[model samples]
Target: MGRVAVTGGTGTLGRTAVCALRAAGHDVVVMSRRTAPGLATADLLTGAGVEAAFTGADVVLHLATSRGTADRWQTQTVVDAVRETGGTARVVYTSIVGVDKVPSSYYRTKLRCEDLLHASGLRCAVVRVTQFHEFLGDFFASQRFSPVLLTPDVPVQPVHVRDAAAALVRVVSDDAVGRLPDVAGPQVLDGRTAARAYRDARGWHRPVLPVRLPGRAFRAYGAGHLCSPDAAVVDGVTFSGWLREQLGSAALT
Candidate 1:
């Protein structure tokens, strides 16, 4: 079994990855800002708590994200820590698809992180994945009282969190390292469809209003720049299937 460390292990994706790794019989360490049993406390933004977390790790799965501009620093710090640790063989970084094509600050930061990982001289695999199904729910929940879902007129290939976790585990277990093909869900669905699915799943009686975002990011999404026509890896769960599993019969619209 490999000694594996997962940053942001408390997060949805990270926690799933940790569970998968442990199930696969790897010695797993979860690094997060908060303290949990068998978890190493680390704050990537301040770089205050990473050294101990990274020590003696054979594989580092970087799944942490920072708020705003701090993301760049956090990613660099993680890369540097892995390099300093010496025994680290593979650095698996989770990035968003179409980071280069999207003209958003978050995507730009993600691109920068990818660049840092590639230039770190470490054996790295940058796995770009489509948005998660849960991300849409979170987005809708961000606003209160309006009871209306607002979304850009763009297509998205949303993958389940479990599928993403499985893919990450596969990469960590294999010797192949580099920019793997983009990972996406099996089917293509637009934002409105995703919102409607969420609404149905939650039994939410809200109107979903589609808004066209005026930017390169929106255009890229509309043009399918964020999706891979030749996706290297495809997850099994469809968006509707995942929603039904999560919400049961309530997911039917």
Candidate 2:
């Protein structure tokens, strides 16, 4: 195991990845904007102190993200720091599944980051992942005060961040040279079905309405581009199981 610097190390997936890497016996350093006892302050937005943080790192986990195309600049900063430091660290970038398919500005930014790494002339790997379990959970929670739960009239294969983090560890540990297979959940659930299940779990009895929003991105989502056909479903907790674990099994349908 070698030194690994994780950008956005305090984030949801970042925290899990850092733990997995450390448990795998790799030396890990967390890089964030705020300075902490064990974290190296490296703001990817401004490229501040990134070189020093990436120095001597065997692999750099690029987990930092931003809204819209700001991710493009952030990824460029990481690449530039790696080059400026004269380090040959393999960068493991965490990307979203269907970055190439979705027409959303955020997905475009993700694809741009991928392109930047491929063109940066550095050893890098890209792993696309499906929506996290928390993502769906948050959606239901957002509708807590609503009279009806508005679910998207589309299917989604959501994965647990813990499993995604574990896959990320494997990518970093192995010969990560290029784009790897997509990671996804074990099962795919429709909008209304998933919403009903989520409603039961939260003990919030409400009418679940599956609505279709008009947008290119929403249409892309409805087309199942987010759920890649070649995705490797990880053997981990499912969405319903995760809900039970979080909200208890008593409130389930």
Best by TM-score: 2
Model 2 lDDT vs. the true structure? Answer: 0.88
TM-score of 2: 0.96
Worst 10 residues of 2 by lDDT: 228-237
Candidate 1, residues 115-136, lDDT tens digits: the string is 9888888888899998887876
lDDT of 1 at 214: 74
Task: List runs of model 1 lying over 4 Å from the truth.
Answer: 142-148, 204-207, 232-235, 250-253
lDDT of 1 at 231: 68
Q: Give candidate 2 misplaced runs (Cα > 4 Å).
A: 250-253
On lDDT, the candidate that comes out on top is: 2
lDDT computed for candidate 1: 0.81
Q: Candidate 2: give the clashing pairs.
A: none
User: Compared with the true structure, what per-residue lDDT tens digits does model 2 show for residues 49-88?
Assistant: 8999999998999998889667899999999999987849
